[model samples]
Target: MQPQLQQQQQQHVLLQQLQQQQHVLLQQLQQQQQQYVLLQQLQQQQQQHVLLQQLQQQQHVLLQQLQQQQHVLLQQLQQQQHVLLQQLQQQQHVLLQQLQQQQHVLLQQHV
Candidate 1:
């Protein structure tokens, strides 16, 4: 082969190798970027999950507090009802005694 032709062929082979290496490097860089995006998404999902759990816990606490308040209110209402019932019984007794005294007075006057 002529010396100049051999040198040109060698340069051409070097150029092809460089191009192939560049393509492989580009592929690797793209794969790394995709992996980074996936990692970010996973982190966001984990954060959301943690927030959800915290909210659920808070809800449970609020529910327990509401139930306790309801129980206390029920007890208070029962106590008030008992007091009213006692007042009604006393009023009935007083009315009955007055009727009996009036009847006695009428019987004496008739005799």
Candidate 2:
């Protein structure tokens, strides 16, 4: 009877040890899952950084193209204005000559 009682006590101690080991294993699994989640988030952030860099590069190229187009349009406008000014000056000279001729003819007839 005494030996049977000792055996039961030993079995109970063994069951408690097994339960403690299982608890430790569960805690370790939870920690590993958390680490995996953190690694995934880090990878996503890196991908976003790369995408942002590409967009900025494209924006810079577009800005340069716009400035070049503006420069060309401004040159064309200045050339057109210069041509119009020359034409206006020529027209003014022709009108002045016509007026002078008319005045001279009228004075001669009066005299």
Candidate 3:
């Protein structure tokens, strides 16, 4: 009978040891899960940073295109203004010639 009681006690100790080992394994699994989550967050942040850089690059290119277009438009406007002024000058010269010819004809009639 004493041997039987001793065996039961030994069995209980073994069972307790197994429970402890199981608890340790659960703790390790929880820690691993936490590490995995942190790594995922870091990866997400890196992707966002890359996307932001791409957007900034696109914005810069758009700004350069707008500036180039503005420069071309300004040049065209200057050319158009120059042509208009030249035409106005030519018209004034022709009007002056017509007035002078009319005055000469009137003077001849008066004679």
Candidate 4:
């Protein structure tokens, strides 16, 4: 009976230790899964940031093109205005010359 009791006590201690080891292994597995989830989330965030940067770069390029087009259009409009002003000045000069010639003809006829 003494031997049997000793054997039973040893088995009980071994069973408790095995249960503790199993609990520790389960905790380790949970920790590893949590770490993996965190890593995946970080990777996803990195990909999203890269995509946003690319989009911003594209937008910057497009904005630059628009500004360049606007500048070219303004230059063309300025050139057209300058040409129109020159034409008006030339027409006024021609009209003034014609008036002077008509007046000179009348004065010669009267004399």
Preferred candidate (lDDT higher): 1 or 2: 1
RMSD of each: 1.9, 2.1, 2.1, 2.7
lDDT of 2 by residue, 1-111 (tens): 999999999999999999999999999999999999999999999999999999999999999999999999999999999999999999999999999998999999999
lDDT of 4 by residue, 1-111 (tens): 999999999999999999999999999999999999999999999999999999999999999999999999999999999999999999999999999998999999999
Where is model 4 more than 4 Å wrong at Cα?
95-111
**Residue 48, model 1: Cα distance from true site in angstroms:** 0.9
By TM-score, the better pick of 1 and 3 is 1
> Residue 25 in model 2: shift from native, Å?
1.9
Which candidate number maximizes lDDT?
3
Best by TM-score: 1
Model 1 per-residue lDDT at 14: 99
What C-alpha lDDT, on a 0 to 100 scale, does residue 9 get in candidate 2? 96
Q: Number of clashing residue pairs in every model?
A: 0, 0, 0, 0
Q: In angstroms, give how far residue 63 of model 3 lies from its true place.
A: 0.9
TM-score of each: 0.85, 0.80, 0.81, 0.75
lDDT per residue for candidate 1 within 1-111, as digits (tens), equals 699999999999999999999999999999999999999999999999999999999999999999999999999999999999999999999999999999999999999
The candidate 3 region of ten consecutive residues with least summed lDDT is 96-105
- Can you write out model 3's per-residue Cα lDDT over 4-84, one digit (the tens) per residue? 999999999999999999999999999999999999999999999999999999999999999999999999999999999
